[model samples]
Target: MYNRIILKLSGEALAGEKSGVNFDNDVIKAIVGQIKKIVSNGTEVALVIGGGNFWRGRSADSKMDRCKADQIGMLATVMNAIYVADFLNQDGVEAVVQTPFKCGTMTEEFSKASALNHLKNGRVVIFAGGLGHPMFSTDTITALRGAELEADALFFAKNVDGVYDSDPNENPNAKKIDEIKCEDIIKNNLKVIDLTAASLCFEQKIPVVIFGLNEENSIVRAVGGQKLGTIVTV
Candidate 1:
C-alpha cells in the first residue's frame, strides 16, 4: 500500500473493447472513474503510460532506423498524454500532462518543480514521453518519476497477474511470486521490470507492485493495501 503513488499503464489497456490503433473515449472515462475514487479519498497520484497500442517503435522498425523508430514512439506517448489530459479534464479532475520532450500543443515541458506545484494543488500529473529521450521504455520513466516524486510505491499494471518465473501465457505452469527482494529479481534475471528500472527502485528502496490490469479492482486493491500481487522490495 502507498500514500502517494505513480501508476504505469500500458497503452494496450486503453484500447477498450476493440482491436485497433485509436483512442477510446469509453475506456478513458472508465479509467478516470476509477481514479476519481482514489482522489476523493485524498490520495496524490501521478501516472506514466505507454503507447504500444498505437505504435511500438521496435515493431515498426523494419526499414526505419532504430533511433527514428524510438523518436516515433516518444511522439506516440505524447499523443496518449494529450488524450489522457483531455479525458481527465472532462472528468472534472485537474490533470496536467507533462513531457520531458517538448510537445507544445500536447503538454508542458516536464520539471520536478512544476510537477510538484501541480501535485500540491491537488492536480493529478500524467508524465509522458519517457524522459524526453530514445531507447528507454516507460518502465524506466516510471521508476525515475517515482524517485523524483518520492512516491511510496510504483504500481505497474501489466497484462499478466504478477511476476512469474516465465511468461505466464507462454508457460502455463510458471510460478507466480507474491513477494520478492529486488536483488534476487536481478540475480534471477526476471523481466518483471527492466534492469534500469529495478536498479533505481533498488537504490531508492521504493516498493514496486506488479499486477494485472485486467483483474477487476486491481488498481484499487493495490492502493487499498490488499496483497493481491507480486511486490518487489529491498
Candidate 2:
C-alpha cells in the first residue's frame, strides 16, 4: 500500500453524470467514504481538484481574454475545494483547503511545509487555485505537488478507467494500457495527461495511477495496489 499519495480529481467527476448541477452528492459521498477508509488504514492523502465542472478556460468565448478566462477557471477550482473539504469535515474526516492565492479567510495559503505538516498530522490537504496562474492546468499542479510532498504515488480519479491507445469512446478497438512509462506517454502524445504534467512526473520519478471514479471503491483499491487501472511510471 502507498504510504502517502496525491489524488487528483477532475471537477467533472464531482458532477458525475448529472446535467445542470454543480455537484452530485452521492458521488461525493461515495468518494469521501473511500477516502475515510484509506485514511483509517494510515495512508496519507493530498488532493488537487480540477475546475472543468464549473468552467473550462479553453472553452470560453473567443472574445474573452485568455488570461481572464483562466482566472475564472482558477476560482472555480477553489470553490470545488471548499465544497469537498466541507463535506469531508462534515463526514468526520479532517480536511483543509489550501490555495496558491489568497481567498480572504476562506482557505490557507499553500506552502510545501504546511501541506506536509497537515498530511503528517492526518489532515487531508486540498490544493486549489491551479498554481495561482494562467496557462497551467490542475494536472500540472498534481505532478508539482506530488513531487514537492514526496508522495508515494499520484492517483488520478478520472471519468475513464484507464489510459488507452486511442480515444475509447471513438474507437471500439482502443486498447487500455495496463502499464506505461511517462516518456512513452509524452512521446506518443497520449491524452492520459497533459505533456507538462507527464514531463514533471518523469523528471521526478513519480508513479501515477489513473482510474475511473465511478468504479466501486476505486480510490481505496488503487492505493492498496489492486491495479484497478493504468499505472504510469517513470
Candidate 3:
C-alpha cells in the first residue's frame, strides 16, 4: 500500500541482551536484513531512530541541567546513526545519515531536499538527532519527515507488538488495538506518539503503522500492509 515509507525504530531495540545503553551488532544486522527485504520489494525507506538505548534526555536532566542532557542525547543518536549506516552499508545497501544538527565526518545536514535526493537515488537515509533540537522527540521528526517526503505511511516499530490501551509492559490486561483514529489516540491518551507528532500526522492526513520489530521481516510486513499491527489514521 505504501510505495515510500518512513520507518522509526526505538533505540532500545538496538540493544541485544543488555537492559539498555549498549549496542548490539547482531541486532543492527537483523534489522538491516529486514530492511533489505523491504527494499527488494521496491519500497523506498527513510529512517528515524530514537536514542533511548544510550541516553534518555529527560532522565539525564535528573542529574545535570536540561540543555546539557539534551545535547548528550543528541550525541547518542548520532553514534547510533553512524553504526546503523555502517551496518547497512556492509549489508550492501547504500545508507546515509543526515542530522538536523551538524556532525562533521558523521552525517550530512538534515533537509527535505537532501533526503529526497537520497530517496530518489535509492539510498536509505537515516534521519538522526531528533530534528536537531531539544524537547522534540524522534516521533516528531518521523511525522515531519513523513509529511515532507509525501510518504504513503509511517511505520513505527518498537519492542511492543502494537499500540495498547495502556503500557503493555506494565499492564497485563491492556488490550492491543488493531486500528484507531488519531483523535482516539489523543483523547484516550494512548502512549503511541507524543501529542505534537500525532497532531502533525493528523493534520497532514498521514497513516501510521505501529508495529513490533522483535519479529523477523516485520518491516517488510508493514510495507506490504499485512495485519501485523495497529493502524492509526484520521
Candidate 4:
C-alpha cells in the first residue's frame, strides 16, 4: 500500500457526469468516502485538482491572453479545492486548502513547511493553483508536489480506466496498457500526461498510476495496492 500519495483530480471528474452542475454532492461524497477509507488505513493523502470543469487554459478562450486564461484556470482550481475540502471536512476528514495565490481566508497560502506539517498531523492537504504560473497544467503540479512531499506515488484519477494505445473514444479496438515506463510514455507521445510533468516524474523517479476514478471503489483499490490501472515507473 502507498504510505503517502498525491491524488490528482480533474475538475470534470468532480462534476461526476452531471451536466450543467458545478458539482455533484453525491459524487463528491462518494469520493470522500474512498479517501476516508484510505485515511483510516493510516495513509497520508494530498490532492491536486484541475479546472477543466470551469475553464481549460488553451480551450476556454482561444482569443484571450494566455497568461490571463491560465490565471483564471488557476482560480477555478481553488474553487475545486475548496469544494473538495469542505466535503472532506463534512465527512470527518481533517482537510486544509493551500494555494499559491492568496484567497483571503478562503484558503491559506501554500508553503512546503505548512503543507508538510498538515500532512504530518494527519490533515489532508489540498493543493490549489497550478505552479502559480501560466502554461502549466495541474499535472505538472502533481509531479512537483509529489516530489516535494516525497509521496510514494502519484495517483492520476481520470475519465479513462488506464493508458491506452489509442483514443478509446475514437477507436473501439484501443488496448489498455496495464503497466509502462516513463521513457515509453514520452517516446510514444501517448498523452498520458504533459511532457514537462512526465519528464519531472521520470527525473524524480516518482511512480504514477493512471486510472478511472468513476470505477466503483477505484480510489480505495488503487491506494490499497490492487494495481487498478496503468502503473508507470522508471
Candidate 5:
C-alpha cells in the first residue's frame, strides 16, 4: 500500500456523463467516500483537479487571448478544488485548498512546506491553479506536487480505465497497457498525459496509477496495491 499519493482528477469526470452540469453529486459522493476510507487507512492524500469541466483554454476561440483563456481555466480549477475540499470536510475528512495565486481568502497560497505539513498532519491538500501559468495542464501540477511532497505514487483518476495504444473511443482495437514506462509514453506520444508532466515524472522517478474513477472504489483499490489499472513506471 502507498504511504502517500497525489491524485489527479479531471473536471470532466466531476461533471459526469451528463452535459450542462457543473458537478455530479453521486460521482463526487462516491469519490469522497473512497477518499475517506483511504484516509482512515492512514494514507496521506493530496489532490490536483483539472478545470476542463468549466473551461478548456486550448479549446477556446482563436480570437481570444490564450493567456486570458487559461486564466479562466485556472479559476475553474479553483472552483473545483474548493468544492471538493468542502465536500470532503462535510464528509468528516479534513481537507484544505491551496493555490499558486491568492484567492482573496478563499484559499491559502501554496507552499511546499505548508502542503507537506498538511499531509503529515493527516489533512488532505487540494492543489489548484495549475502552476499559476498558462499552457500548463493539471497533470504537470500533479507531477510537480508528487515530486515536492515525495509521494509514493501519483494517481490519475481519469475517464478512461487506463492507457491505450490508441484512442479507445475511436478505435475498437485499441489495447490497454497494464504497465508502461514514462519514457515510452513520451516517445510514443500516447496522450496519457502531457509531455511536460510525463517528463517531470520520469525525471523524478515517480510511479503513476491510471484508472477510471467510475469504477467501484477505484482510488482505494489502487492505493491498496490492487492491480486494477495501468501502472506507469518511471
Candidate 6:
C-alpha cells in the first residue's frame, strides 16, 4: 500500500453531468467513502480537485481576458475544496482545505511542510487553487503538488478506466494500455494529462496510476497495488 498519495479528481466526477448546480452531494460522498476506506487502511491522502463543475473559464467567450477567465476558474476550485472538506468531516474524516491563494479562514495557506504535517496527523489535506496562476490546468498542479509533497504515487481517479491508444468513446477499436513509461506519455502526446504535467512527473520519477473511479472499490484497490487500470511508471 502507498504511504501517501495525491488523488487528482476531476470536477466532472463531482458534478455528475449536471450543468447548473455546482456539486452533487451523493457523488461527493461516494468518492469520499472510497477515500475513507483507504484512510482507514492507514494511508495518507491529499486531493487536488478540478473546477470544471462550476466554471470553464476558457469557454466563457473570447471577449473576456484569458487571465481573468482563468482566475474565475480558480475560485471555483476553492469552492469545491471547501465543500469537499466539509463533507469529509461529516463522514468522520478530518480534512483541511489549503489554497495557494489566501481565502481568509476558509482554508490554510498551502505549503509543502503544512500539507505534509496534516497528512502525517491523519488528516486528509485538500489542495485548492491551480498553482495560484492562470494559463495552467489543474492537471499541471496535480503533478507539481505530487512532486513537492513527495507522494509515493499520483492517483488520477478519472472517468476513463485507463489510457487507450485512441479515444475509447469514439473509436470502437481503441485499446487500453495496461502499463507505460512516463516518457511514452510525453512522446505519444497522450491525453491522460497535459504535456507539462506529464513532463514534470517524468522529471521527478513519480509514478502515476490512471484509473476509473466509477468502478466499485477502485480507489482503495489502486492504493493497495491492484493494477485495475493504466500504471504509468518510470
* True-vs-predicted CA distance for residue 59, candidate 1, Å: 1.8
Per-residue C-alpha lDDT of model 1 across residues 1-234, encoded as one tens digit per residue: 356889998888888668764767777787887777777777888989899888887695588888888888878887887788778888888999998866766688989999988887878899988977778989999999999989989999888888888888898888998999998888888887888899899999988899888777788878888887798987
Q: Write the per-residue lDDT of candidate 5 for residues 72-174, one digit (tens) a residue.
A: 9999999999999989999999999999999999999999999989988989999998889888889999999999989999999988899988999999999
lDDT of 6 by residue, 1-234 (tens): 789999998887898766677788888888899888999999999999998888887686878999999999999898898899999999999999998988888899988998999999999998888888899999899899999999999999888899999999999999999999999999988888888999999999999999998888898888899978999988
Write candidate 2's Cα lDDT for 163-206 as tens digits: 99999999999999999999999999998898999999999999
Of the two candidates 3 and 6, the one with more favorable TM-score, higher being better, is: 6
Q: Show model 5 residue runs off by greater than 4 Å.
A: 58-60
The residue ranges of model 2 lying beyond 4 angstroms of the native Cα positions read none
Task: Tell me how far the alpha carbon of residue 158 in candidate 2 is from the true structure, in angstroms, after superposition.
Answer: 1.2
lDDT of each: 0.85, 0.92, 0.86, 0.91, 0.91, 0.90
Error of 4 at 104 (Å): 1.4
Per-residue lDDT tens digits of candidate 4, residues 147-222?
9989999999989999999999999999999999999999998898888899999999999999999899999999
Question: Per-prediction TM-score, please?
Answer: 0.95, 0.98, 0.94, 0.97, 0.97, 0.97
Q: Give the C-alpha miss distance for residue 65 in model 3, angstroms.
A: 1.9
Quick one: best TM-score, which candidate? Answer: 2
Cα error of candidate 4 at position 73, Å: 0.2
Candidate 3, position 126, lDDT: 93
- Runs in model 3 lying further than 4 Å from the true structure: 19-21, 58-63
lDDT of 5 at 136: 87
